[model samples]
Target: MKLVSLNIGKPAELSYKKKTVLSGIKKRPVQTSLYLSNIGFIGDGQADLIHHGGEDKAVCVYALEHYAYWEETFNRPLPPAAFGENVTAAGVLETDVHVGDVFQLGESIVQISQPRQPCFKLAALHHEPKLALLVEETGYTGFYFRVLTEGKVKITSELKRTEIHPAKITISKANTIMNNKNADREDVHMLSQLEELAESWKKPLRIRLQ
Candidate 1:
């Protein structure tokens, strides 16, 4: 897959729902190469660390194809980094990428950890109250990456798959299991046991399986 854009943003206060809140969701594409550390992009910031940034979610990747889908569905234009993804990529979708898949991007190596769970911030950012719900329903919520080899990366870099884990629980499947209230317990248990699945995802599944 090709890395179409590299986006970065810092925390900024914004008026949402008549209240001010700090958010780093409005990222813009960067023209120059940047460092990719274990935590995340060198200049990127996450306002809510509890559900956002960490070793398990260092990079957020969104499929460029989804922008077209959203634009057509919403009847409006959407930018590359509109989803607050660190990498806008082409040729790979959530269904095609498994949770344990590893990829080499420029000089850094990253692994797919889990599907992104849309929150209210998305609706507030786009001014569409149902946007987050639409994303979740469509299962187009992109995915997260955990940095395995820290190095430099650029917008022009290509994403090359280096390894595919044996479990093969795709991000699409994981999203379905998490969002479906009646999801089969056996399936959730199987996915939760994947070593590559993020703790944030497993914790909830474990609770559900109880």
Candidate 2:
């Protein structure tokens, strides 16, 4: 896949539901090269560290392929970084890639860890009450990458897959399963077994199993 754009942002107050809260879901596109680390891009940050900005989810990625559908849905010009992605990608979708898929980005190496768990912050940022649930339901929720090799990654960098995981659990499938109320115990076990999957994801599934 190709990197269409790189985005970054710090925490800022987001107002919604008659309340204001600090959120880091409104990212802006950047044109310069960025230093990628185990935690994230040098300039990137998240307000709620408990649910964001960790080594297992250093880079949030959204596909450019899904933009047309969403733009049509929203009936407006949804631009790059619209989903608060650190990397805007082209030529790949949630169903086409799998957990533990390793890719090289410019001088850095990264690996897919988990599908993005769309939060209320995203819905609030877009002024859509059900947007987060909609994203989860449609399996267009995007995904995250864990940096393996820290280095400078240019905005123009192209991603090349270096390795594929044995489990082959596509992000799309994971999203669908995640939203299912009747999620199978065997399916949950299979998903929990993936070493490349992030603990934030596995923890819930593990609890369900026990």
Candidate 3:
């Protein structure tokens, strides 16, 4: 595996409709960078950045990975993503990754914290009526990060697989939580905490449940 691109974007206003209610929301993609600090969350075990409802965050996201790597969608270089990811890696299969998997990028060590879970913001990015349905059909999106060590990383940085586990949660489970309409604020908090468990395991989980 290798890093292909480092991406980031700023927040912008977008419109959404639910029933008879139409609303505009402000959201930003974290600034992507080659270095750790500029990337958002940078720590020894894992790094994190907030993902907007319709955008990607700092660490990892699937984007077009599920769709056979599109060069352009909506006339943009990147497919819809919540926040810009710091590293775009080739040969990093989302489903294949497990908790203990170790990815070596430049001088950095990254572990797969969990599968990426998407939100309503995906509809904003695509402007599609059934964006959520499309995502359910294709599971090649979203990724998580646990930084083992800090170091410089650049576009096209080589991603070496140092370790991986065989048994782990499926990507589908992660999305189930992320996409649940009935999920309350407490549920979201629980999902966030699961990232810690993903750090030490040989294979991180796809979803966090009590």
Candidate 3 residue-wise lDDT, 118-206, digit = tens: 45555655566566566565665557666777677655467787875454544444455455745565645545555433432212223
Worst window of 10 by summed lDDT in candidate 3: 44-53
lDDT of each: 0.91, 0.90, 0.49
Model 2 scores a TM of 0.97
- Estimate candidate 1's alpha-carbon lDDT, on a 0 to 1 scale: 0.91
Q: Against the correct fold, how does model 1 do in TM-score?
A: 0.98
Instruction: Write the residue-wise lDDT of candidate 1 on 152-180 in tens digits.
Output: 99877778998988888888999999998
- The 10-residue segment of model 1 with minimum total lDDT is 11-20
Question: In model 1, what are the clashing residue pairs, if there are any?
Answer: none
Q: Kindly list the per-residue Cα lDDT of model 2 for residues 42-150, writing each as its tens digit.
A: 9989999999989998999999998998888899888679898999989669989999999999899999999999899989988989999888877898999999999
Sort by lDDT, best first: what order?
A: 1, 2, 3
Off by over 4 Å in 1: none
Clashes of each: 0, 0, 20
* Candidate topping lDDT: 1
TM-score of each: 0.98, 0.97, 0.60
